[model samples]
Each structure stands twice: as structure tokens, then as C-alpha cells.
Target chain A: MLQFSFWDILSNLLIATQWTIVLSLIAFVCGGVVGLILLFMRVSGVTPLEWFTKGYIEFFQGTPLLMQLFLFFFGIALFGVEVSPWMAATLALTFWTSAFLTEIWRGCVDSIPKGQWEASSSLALTYIEQMRYVILPQASRIAVAPTVGFSVQVVKGTALASIIGFVELTKAGTMLNNATFRPFLVYSLVALIYFCLCYPLSWGAKKLEGRLNVAR
Target chain B: MTYKLQFAELLPYWDVLLQGLIFTIILTLVSTAAGIAVGTAGASLRTFGPKWAGAIVTTYVELIRNTPFIVQLFFIFFGLPAAGVMLSETTAAFLAMTINLGAYSTEIIRAGIQAVPKGHVDAGVSLAMTKWEVLRHIILNQAFRKIYPALSSQIIIVMLGSAVVSQISAQDLTYAANFVASRNFRNFEVYLLAALAYLLLAMLTRSLLRGLGRVIFKAK
Candidate 1:
């Protein structure tokens, strides 16, 4: 077996970090968009939409993300269309993230007082208008901390993409560990890198949560 | 353009699948209990331990929280043996999972413990209850009641996260699926069947936890 140098491992990890970030950004953005739609559908006046959204949330939330990733990777192919690992990972993460994000944002939106909806409606605003002008703005404030917090989950989740052959930090660590035959040191470094990436956001989320609690 | 779906091909493997399911359940149960124990200790350290201890706990929680479980598993299974702490693949997988679940559960349970009202503790003290007594009879009980939902949810997450162990070849449900798929070259069908099995298992576990919670927390 060829021995990998420290510099080689570091450089490879750095390269893999880009994929992690890219995967995270894609998942977050796509999840945000889908989550918004699910949120509205969840609370929308239409009954079928509400039920459908609830089922969607439960189905994704109930199952393991690994299974979801596998389903997307292989499930789609079973129907005769081929998808790359990146595409499969993105789709799975986006769907998984959206389910949880919808729930989080729904809680935020629900925490807004019932009176605001009535007050906006009294001002001759339509339902969409009221949401646009009043409810969403207030809800968005409450949403910020949790949203940022959930992004940390998204970041951590990108690691699962590695299972399906999407090479990210975790996958890179495996490669390095295989070559160096040094599991503990490599994984400790991997954990440290992840801590560096996640701790700041966790701190920020806590700070924001504290401020929000005070404001309330 | 027309490949017929074959359910019959998978029927003979039902016995293997059933065994795989049982193993998955056993793994989940063992890890969940072990995780709760580790988590409770970690949570107590954060809540009631000294400064340095709290800092250590904080560092551990953050480290486990940030990194991926797959990496952690690889380190334990593949990494530790290199350092002379050799363990079987299954043992290593379980140990890694216990630690990972412990860190996350520590945070959840800590939040639950902190959510207990100050008045309750004061009341316990006024009744001449010792610190340990207050913690056990009053504070801890109430905290568990409050955090049961979060704890249950975290347990499910742990169960799901357990799937990562397959990478270390633990012969769990996912590993079985991987093996069956390779043997039959029916990757999609095998995984699809495995996904259904996972979904059923998740639902079953959730209901079981819910029932247990109801039985334990009669007031709830």
C-alpha cells in the first residue's frame, strides 16, 4: 500500500471540502424553496394540500436519510432513467431538508399571533397580500435562528452523500485513512474540521435564539 | 422499454430479510439504551459538573455534532485497531454509534433538564430533600416528562443513523440489501424493498416508543 503524506491528506481534504460546501448550498437552497411550498400547503385552506403536505413531511421525517439517499440513487434508475451521484444526492438531501425545514418554519409561522391575520384582512388585504405584508415578515424574524441552526444539519448531512460515491470530506477521510492506516488521527482531524465549520454557526444560532427570546 | 418487475425473485430471500430485520431491531434497542445512559451522564456533567468538566462535555458535544457519523465509525472500526485497541466490526460500529447518539442526546436532555422550573427545585429543597434526592425524585422526573418528545425523536434519529454501520460491514438491514443486490444484480429492486422495510421499522419503533412513554409517564 502506498503511504499518503500529511500534506497529501490535507490537500485532498481541502478539495473535498468544496464539494461539501457545494452540496450543502444546493440542499439548503432547494430545501428552502420546497420547504416554503410545503409550509404553505401544510397550512393552506385547501384540505387535500394540507393532508398531502403532512404525509410528505412524515414520510421523509420518518425514514432514515440513508434509505432516502439509496431510494433516490437506485429508485430512479429502476424506472429506466439514469442519474449521476451528484444529482441523486442533491435530490435526496433537498427532499429530506425540506421536510424538516417545513416543520421548523411552520412552527415559526404559527407562533405569530392570530390577531395579525385578522388585522391585515381588515385592511382590505387579500390572503396572499396579508401573508406578504404582515405574517411572513414577522415569522421570518423568528425563523432566522432555527433556519441557521438547521443549516448546520444540512452541512453535517452532506457527509451522507459520500455513501453513494459523492466524494466529500467524510469520503476523503476514508480514502486518507485507508492509505495512511491511521484512523484515529485522520478522523480526529476530520472531526476538528467539522467542528470549525459547525461551531460558529451553532454559536450564532444560540446568540440569535437568545436575542429572539429576549425580544419576545 | 419494458422490464417486468419481479416480486417472486425476492420471495426466497424472505428468511434472510427477516433475520436482517431482527438484527436491525436488536441493534437499535441496544444502542438506544446505551446512548441514553451515556447521554444522561453527559447532560448531568453539563448541568451540574465543575467548570473544566463542563468545558470537556461541551467540546465533546460539538465535536460529535459537527462531524459525520460515517467518519466516526470508520475511525473506531478501522482507526482504533491500528492504535492497538482492536475490536470486532460489529463491536466497533456499536461503540461509535453509542458515542454519537450520546452526544446528541446529551444536548436534548440538557435542554429538558434546564427547562425544569426553578420553583420545583426550591420546593424540593424546602421539603428537606437532598440534592441527589431532588435531582432524582423531582428534577429528573419532571425533566424527563418535559423532554420525552425530544428524547423519543432523538432515539429515532439514532436508529436511522445506525444505517451508517453498514459501511463497516455490520450485516444490518442495509448491509443485507447491499449484499442481496450485488448477488442478484437487482440493485434498484433490492434497495426499494429495503426502503420499505426501513419505513416499516421506523414506524414500528416510533409507535413502540410512544406507547412506552405513555406507560411510563402516566400523567402525560
Candidate 2:
């Protein structure tokens, strides 16, 4: 059996952490785009689109992300297209994150008071212009802290990708544990790394929230 | 390239799926009960206890909140034996779920506790109510009433996240899905049905909790 040093395990885990970061970034960015579209559909004043968006958010929110991943991984492959774990994880996480983001953004948009909507409309502004110039700008301000807070969830959510065999931080930790037979050390380090990745975001969200409250 | 969706193939495995669903519900019930207890105790201690006790709880809450649920489950299930703490798969799953919810609800409950107006506490004090009396009758009731919706949502979220327990080979619904999928070679159908089962379970749990909330706080 090959002898593995401490540095070997640490360095390998560090290397894999980059993929976690990359996946989280991609999911966050893509999810944000999808969420924006869903938000528009949800608030568009068109009943069918609004109903569709509501159902989309509810389905994604209600199901576990693991099942969503499994569905994409196997469902897509069943259609004669091979689906990698990476692709499946990305698709699932993106859709899951969008559901949450749209819901959060909707709450922010809804908080702008009906009077703001009425005032914007009474200015003879079109719906698009009202949203562009009046509603979204104000909602975005309140949306900042919660949005950052949710990114922590997105980062944590990527840990599930490891179960599907995406060799991210958690997967790398498990593989290393098999090699080194040090489950305690490997998993604790894996968790610590996640904590480091997530805590700053959580802290920043708190600070922004505090500042926002003070400003109000 | 041509694949027909055959959910009918899963009918033979209905009993196995039902067993798994029951186990998932049991896990949710146990964790939700214990987790809320842990949260209430932790919140009370953090808000009213000595400085060091509050700091200790704050650290625990932060550690658990920032880590992933699967990693925490892996740590308790796989890693703890190395440190001389052996836990069965079910026990570890339960512990992980409870601890995860405990951390989240401590924050939520703490917020609720803090939101209790100071004037109410002052009035309770002036009324000659003991500290415990005040906490029980005056403070906690209002806090629970205010934070009931958030606490219910957290419980549901933990229930959904419990699907990860199957990764540790716990006999949850997801594990049953994986078991049948591997045997039947119907991975997509198995998982889709399992997802639908979960969605139904979530809806059921939500309504159940909503009813419970109405009963508990009905006087208010």
C-alpha cells in the first residue's frame, strides 16, 4: 500500500474545493438569470404565466434537490442523451436556486407597497417602464442582503453534487477517507472548508441587513 | 432512443416505497420534536443565561448553520466512530437532522424571543410574576405566536433535507427509491415517483403543522 502524507490529503482536498467554487458560481449566475425571468412571469399581470411560474416555484421548492438531480441524471439519459453527473447537478441546482430566488425577489418586489405601483402607473408610464424605472430599482436595494444570504445556501447545496459522483469538496473528502482511512480528519476538514466558504457570506449578509435597518 | 415512461412497473414495489415513506415520516417527527426542544432550550439559555453559555451556543449554532447537512450526517455517521462514538445509521440520521434543525431554530427562536417587547417584560416584573412565570406566560407565548410561521417552514425544510439520510444507507424514502431503481433498472421512473411522493408528503406536513399552530395559539 502506498503511504500518504498529511500534505497529500490536504492538497488533494484543496484542489477539489476549486470545483465546488466553480460549480457554485455557475449555478448562482445561471440561477439568477432564470430567477429574473421567472420573477417577470410571476409579476407580469398575465394570469397563465403567473400561474405557471407559481407552480414552477412550488414544485422545485417542494421536492428535495437530490431527487431533482437524480431525475435529470437518469431522465435525460433515458432520452438517448448521456448526462454526466456534473451536468445533472448543475441543472438541478440551477432550477432549485431559481425557485428560491424568484420567491425571495417577489417578496421584495411585493414589499414596495401598492401605492408605489399605483403612483408609477398614474405617471402614464407603461408597465415595462414602471418596473424598469420605479419598482425594480427600489426592490433591488432590499433584495441585496437576502440574496447574499441565499448564496450560502447555494454553496451548501453543491455538496449534494458529490453524491452523484461530481468530485467536489465533499466527494474528494470521501475518496480521500477511503484512501487514508481517516474519516474523522477528512470530514472535519471538508466541513471546515465549507464553513470558511459560507461564513463570510453569512456575516456579510448580516452586516448589510443591519446597515439597511439603520438606514430605514 | 425511444423510451416510454412506465410508472406501472413501480407498482410491485409499492409496499417498499410505503415503508420508506413511513420511515421518513418517523424521522421527521422525531427530529422536529427533539429539534424544537433543543432550539427552545438553546434560545432561552442564549438569551438569559450567563455570558459563557451564550457564547458556547452561538458557536455551536454557527458551526452547524454554515456546514452542509450531508457533510454533517457523514461526519456523525462515518467519522464519529473514529473518535469512539459509535452510532447506528438511523440514530446518526436522526441526530444529524435534529442538530441541523436545532441550530436553525435557535436563531429563529432567538429572534422571536428578542421581538418580545421590553415593556411587556417590565409589566410582568411589576406584576410580581417570577422570571419563569414571565417567560412562560408573557414572553414565550408572544414569541411563539410571532415566529410560528418561520418555525413551521424550517421544519418542512429539514424534512425535505432529510432525503440525504438515505446516502448513509438509512431506510428513508430515497433509499427505497434507489433500491427499487437498481433492481428494476428504472432509475428515472423510480426517482420521479419518489419525488412526487415527497411533494405529497411535504404538502401533508405543511397542512398538519398549520392546523397544529392554530390549535396551540388559538386563544391568542
Candidate 3:
């Protein structure tokens, strides 16, 4: 068994932390774009589009992220496409994040009272204009907390990418634990790092949730 | 890409899949029950206990919430053995899952408890109810009614998360899928079947929770 120093494990984990952050950003940005489109499609009131978006959300949300990662990693290989672990991880995460973010944003859009839409329609605003000017502006206020809250899930979800050999924080922890033969110590540090990354967002989410509750 | 989607390859593995499904269900139910117990205790401590107790529960919640479940699972499964606390993969997976579900449920249930109006508690107090009685009859019940949907959703998510335990060779659905896929060399078909199985499981769990909510809360 390979032996590793404490500093060596820490440094490796620190380096791997960058990948975790980068992957999260990539997944967040791409998922945000796709999620926005999905939200629009869901609210467009087109039956097929609604069904398609719903199906997309359910497919990702209903299944485990680990299975999705496995499918992307191994399933794509069968089609004669040489996909890297990074590509597969990113694709799975982006799709998964998009499904959730779409549902989240759609709830935000829906939470705007019906009277706002009716009033906007009475003023002869097109659907696009109403969304751009009236609906979204108000909806965004309600959306902020849940969106921020969901980011915590995204960060945690990125840990699943390590299963496909993406070498993020969790994967680094596993490697270090293997070398050091100290599972609890290595994992506690890993958990600590993740807590540092996630707790502020959790606190912020709670704070925003409180503000939202008080506002209503 | 000339890949044909042949699900027929998975036909023989239906029994294995069923076994995996049963295991998955058992794991979910056990963890969920254990989780609720932990969550209730944590939430109560956080809400009404001394300062140190509240702080400790808060710390536990944050630690579990932030870390990846897989890491948590590894720590329990692989790490514990190093400390001479060996457990089978299934037991470790179940323990990690219960702990994870407990933390999230604590937060949700705490919110539910807090959402119970002060007047309800005051009324319970005025009726000569002891603190424990008031907590049981008023606060806890009302919180459950309010948080049932959120709790149920979390339970379904936890069930989905059980797939990760396959990494430790727990023979959950994902493990079975991995086995069938490698044996049949039909990776796409096996996963598609697995995904459908998961989807069906999710639907079934949700409906069951809905029925449960109706029975428990009388709100359906």
C-alpha cells in the first residue's frame, strides 16, 4: 500500500477543490441557461412542450445522480464516441441541474399572483412583454432564496461526479484515505471542507427564507 | 452511431432487479424511520434544549448537509473498519443514509415546528397541558401536518440516493444494473431499464407517501 504524508493529502485535496468549484460553476451556468429555456417552455402553455419539459424534469429528478453519471460515462461509450470522464460528469450534472432549476424557476414564475398576469393582459402587454417587464421582476424576488438554496444541492451533487473518476474533492478524499489508511480523519477533513463551502449558503438560504416569509 | 437499444438482454435479470428493488425499499424504509427519530430528537433539542445542546445539533446538521453522501458513506464503510469498527457494506450504507436523511429532516421539521402558531402552544398551555403533552399533541402533530409534503419529497430523494450505496457493493438497484450491464455488454439498455425502475419506484413512493399523508393528516 502506498503511504502518504498528512500535508500531501491536504495539498491534494486543496488542489482537487478547484475542480469541484469549476465543475460547479460550469454546471450552474449551463444548467441556468437550459433551465431558463425549460421554464419558458413549461409556462408557454403548449401541450407538447409542457409535456416534454415535464418529462425532462421527471427523468432527471426521479432517478439517482449516480445512475445518471454511470449512464453518461458508460452509455455514451457504446455509441463509438470517446467521451472523457469530465465530459460525462459535466453533461450529467448540467442536465440534472437544469431539470431542478427549471422546476424551481417555474415555481417562482407561478408564484406571481394571477392578478398580475390579468392586469398585464388588460394593459395590452404581450406575453413576452409581461414576462420581461412585470412578471419576472416580481418573481425574481421570490426566486432568489430557492435558487440560492438549490445551489447547495448542486455543490453536493458534484460529489457524485467523483464516482466517474472526475477527481474532485470526494475522490481526492478517497485516494488520500486509501493511502493514509485513515478513513475517519480523511473524511472528517473532507466533510469540514464541504461544510465550509456549503454552510454559508445554507445560512443565507435560511435567512432569505425568513425574509420571504416575513414579507408575505 | 448504429447502436440498437435491446432491452431483451435484461429479461433474465428481472429477478435480480426485483431482489435489488426489495433491498432498496427495505433500506429506504429503515433509514427513513430511523431518520425521523433522529430528526425529531435533533429538532427538539435545537428548539427547546440548552445552549450547548442546540449548538451541537446545529453542528451536526451543518456537517451532514454540506458533505457529499458518498463521502459520508465511505467514511462509515471504509473508514470505520480502520478503527476496528467493521460493518458490512449494507449496514454502513444504511447508517450513513439514515444520518444524512436525519440532518435534512431536522431542518425541515424544525421549520415546520416553528411555523406552528404561538397561539396554539398558548392554548395548549392554558388547558393545563404539560410541556411534553403540548409538544406531542400540538407542536409535533401540527408540524408533521405542515411538513408532510416536504418530508415525503425528501424521503423520495433519499430513496434515489440509495443508488450511491452500490459503490460499496450493497447490491442495490444500481449495483444490479452494473452487474447486468457488464455481463450482457448492453450498458445503455441496462441503465435505461434501471432508470425506468427508479422512476417507477419514485412514483410508487410518492403515491404511498401521499396516501400516508391522507391517513395521518386527514388532508387528502
What DockQ do you compute for every candidate structure?
A: 0.66, 0.88, 0.75
lDDT at residue B11 of model 1 (Cα atoms): 75
C-alpha RMSD of candidate 3: 1.8
Tens-place lDDT per residue, model 3, B1-220, is 7877888878998998889888999999999999999999999999989999999999899889888898899888987887889999989988999999999999999999999999999999999999999999999999989998999999999999999999999989888888888798888888888888899999989999998788887743
- Candidate 3 lDDT score relative to the true structure: 0.91
Model 2 C-alpha lDDT per residue in residues B83-194, reported as the tens digit of each score: 9999999999999999999999999999999999999999999999999999989988899899999999999899999999999999999999999999899999999999
lDDT, candidate 2, A1-216, per-residue tens: 987798898899999999999999999999999999899889989999999999999899999999999998998998799789999999999999999999999999999999999998999998889889999999999999999999999999999999999999999999999999999999999999999999999999999999999989
What TM-score does chain A of model 2 get? 0.98
Best by lDDT: 2
lDDT of 3 at A55: 95
Task: Estimate the TM-score for candidate 1.
Answer: 0.95
The better candidate by lDDT, 1 or 3, is 3
* Residue A11's lDDT in candidate 2: 92
Residue pairs in collision within model 1:
none
Off by over 4 Å in 2: none
* Model 2 chain B: lowest-lDDT 10 consecutive positions: B211-220
Q: Which pairs clash (backbone N, Cα, C closer than 3 Å) in model 3?
A: none
